[model samples]
Target: MVMSLGQGLWMAINAIYAVTVVHLTPGQLGVSVSVAAAIVLVCSIPLGHLADRTGPRTVQMWSFLASAPLTAALLFVSGFWTYLVVVSAQAIAYRAGRSARKAMIAGLILPADRVSVLAYVRAASNVSVSIGACLAGLVLAAGSRLGYQGAVLFTAVAFLLTGALTAREPRVPPVPATAGSALAVLRDGPFLTFTILDGLLTTHALLLDVVLPLWVLRRTDAPRWMSAIILVVNTVLVVGTQTKAARGTDTPAAAARASLQGAGCVAVACVVFAMSDEAALVPACLLLVSGALAHALGEVRQAAGSWAIAFDLAPDHAQGQYQGTHAMGADLGKMFAPAVFTWLVLEHGALGWIVLAVGFAALGTAMPAVVSRGVRMRSGSDPVISTG
Candidate 1:
């Protein structure tokens, strides 16, 4: 419940940030997001180390508690550079907090069920985000800066409350890593492949962030209100489809199948988005909603696959480090996608969208084969592994 509330408020605040405060051209906005994401990627490894050395709960509590004020400070700032600094800080806090949270989940949930729980958590988050985005849209439409400011301010309060809630929870026992454990992770080939593949999949997904908005506004002559359209599409698909999409995918093989199908969906949706010149709002809406659902399905399956694979491979003492490294792949995708896609759009126009579509489609087709190989290698060494 706390996670849901936090996501809802954060999503609303994020929409406000994109619309009001972070004033940049499309490419510049992409650059800002990329830079911030790069910072998160760099920080993730160290932060994971911290979570392991300390405890994931400790990291989560402190990060959450600190993030509230930093986020609220955005209300007073007016300049782009200042916004960047503050937003970057928020990004750091969020990434660190998330790693800790995921690690905490690892401690309690059985590896096999972790994907289902993650899916449930994601569904709750999307539902909350939808609520938050809708409220933000209402505030924007009303032209109430004070009200919008109040909504953001309230979000900070909610974060504080969430921190308090987390503090009251039981802590996980600290897991220790021996010398050379981190170095060992660096040399693991299948692990590296999984990370890289996950990164590529994620990178393609983020094209929807800054680029989609700009495309809608500039190419379709969409009203500023059209931003809400995309959000709605994402909200409905996530809320409606993710749980079912994640169901019946317990084994590594099954999970890979779901991911491949989901990837195909993403490719088709993106192509439809690119071809929507005459269809206007309907095509854009379909692209946004269908793509979101497909991408989210892939997230559910890939998350399950990654967790199962990592838990199988990780030494008992080094779980946190492995999870953290896994998390960094996601951050790297977030970092690189914006810059790459922004360049593609500028240089190639509609061709860029087609390229992104094809890349995603290919990944979808290929992931199952790769995952199957990894699963086979893992099973050979650890036949009775506990997979989450």
Candidate 2:
């Protein structure tokens, strides 16, 4: 909740703040954000290794501590370089702790209940983000530099409080490293393939975040306010239904099936969204709402399924490194989402949406087979195990 609130407060105004206060051009802002993601991508593995060596709790606490000051330092950035440095540092600190935090969750929950717990966390995060974004909206309305600074400061304090709270959580014992090097995760073929597939599946999220808004603005006749409503619908649905979606994703096979179902929902949503292109405003609004709800359901199912697969496949002793490796998929997806969606969906129009839907279905269909193969291989001679 703390993390989501902080993120929401800053994200609501980050682009405007950069342009008006930091004086960065749109292109520069884009480049700097990309650079920050790249930094996280490059550092994820090493930080995960660090988490494995020490413990997730320790690494997570320190990461929050490091991130708080860097986030606050954003208030002082004067130029593009300074902005890049501060943003990049904050990104690094945040990403560095992600795997450890995930590993900590894995350690805390039963395997059968991980998805449910994750769903609750995700739901809570959405609620908190909504609150934060609404608060930030009030601040943004004030239109003062001091208001923006206050938002940043609020984020900084949130991080500080989070770090302090994290420090107080019960500690989990670290698994002793069995391998000589952290790079061992790179050599795990099945896990690597899983990561790639996970990355592909994650593109759906990118579609919702980047493609949907652009499509609504450029392709549909719906009013601008509908975009905000679509997002609200998605958030509300996730908050209300995520735990229910995660109910039966306990086993690997069940999770794989859930993912396939999720893909189907996403495909249906895409087709529904496509129909809005030339429709009347009422029809377009209804279709958009329907699509958003479907997409939200897909998001919940995919997230629940992915958690099970990820936790099931990761080696117990190296959960941090494996989870970190899994995170690379999200990083890569975010990095390429804009260019990929522009070329594949936006520029091509409605046909592009169909193509993406088909692609999602294909990926979803293949996931079960891939997971089965990994399970078979593990059961044969490799015997991958999770102590958590």
Candidate 3:
């Protein structure tokens, strides 16, 4: 929650701060962010390997400490190049910590409780991010460059505190590096396949964050406020029900089943969203709400299931590297989502949404077989997929 809150505070105002205070153009900002994301994507595996060798707790703490100053450096960025350097450095520090953090969770928690614990953390994160965003709104309402600067400073302090807290966390012993290079993950065909499939599943996030709001405004009669309303509803529902949705996904098969259910909800949401385009205002609003609810439900199920698959499939000795490799899929999905979703939903409209829906459903349907086959190939026993 602390980490997410800090992220929320910065994210809510960063673009505006860049435009108004740092005087960067939208295109420059986009390029800088994309570049930063690319850096994270390229660096994650190496950093994860470091964590595997040196211990996740140590790497996580140091990464947080490193990020504090880099985040604060945003205040001094005046040009596009300076902003890019600062933001990219900050993203490198941030992304470097991610796999270690996941490894820490896996190291400390029993597998049976992993999904529930992750759900709880995610719920808290949603609530805290909402609070942080509200606070950022107040800061922006103060309407000055100094106010934005203060927001950046607050984020830096938050990172410092989080780093301090992490430093004091109970340490988990490092796993000794094996004979092969960390890049050996590249040679693991089944794991590579799983990661690609996982990445595809993450496209649903783009559907919610990018496609839905644009579709509502450009194609439907629903009021603009409905978008904000839908976001709030999704947040509230996720916070309230994620733990419940996480139940019963204790095995690979069960996790795959949950993912399939999530895909079905997402598909239904697309159909409902399409109907809103031609409906009366009141009916459109209702359909929009219904779609948002379905999307949120799908998000909850997918998150739970994905966590299970990722944690369970990872080799015990190479957890950090494996987690890092899994994370790459998400980064890749998010990087491509804007262009892909825009072309599909905005350019082609209802038929495009249906096509996406079918695609998602097909992927979900294939997941069980894919997971089963991959696990069998890896372990030579179907029941090993159920192991914690």
Which candidate number would show the highest TM-score if scored against the true structure? 1
TM-score of each: 0.85, 0.84, 0.82
Clashes of each: 2, 0, 0
Worst 10 residues of 2 by lDDT: 379-388
- In terms of lDDT, the poorest run of 10 residues in model 1 is 379-388
Which should have the higher TM-score, number 1 or number 2?
Answer: 1
Please give the TM-score that candidate 3 achieves against the real structure: 0.82
Task: Give the alpha carbon lDDT tens digit for every residue of 34-114 in model 2.
Answer: 677777888888888888888899999989989889989988999999998998898788877888888888778776677
| Candidate models: Cα lDDT each | 0.66, 0.78, 0.77
Candidates 1 and 3 compared: the better one by lDDT is 3
Q: Rank the candidates by lDDT, best first.
A: 2, 3, 1
Screening candidate 3 with a backbone cut-off below 3 angstroms (N, C-alpha, C), the clashing residue pairs are none
After best superposition, candidate 2 residue 117: deviation in angstroms? 1.9
- RMSD of candidate 1 to true structure, Å: 3.8
Tens digits of per-residue lDDT for model 1 on 1-388?
A: 6545545545534534555554555565666677787788777767766777688899999888888998789787676677678778988898788777777777777876776777787777777777766765665566466766777787788778888888887797776654334445566666667777766775645645556656555665445445555665666667777677667677767777766776666676566566643346666555555555555555545454555545555554555666777777777776768767766765566777789889888877787787777777666763533322
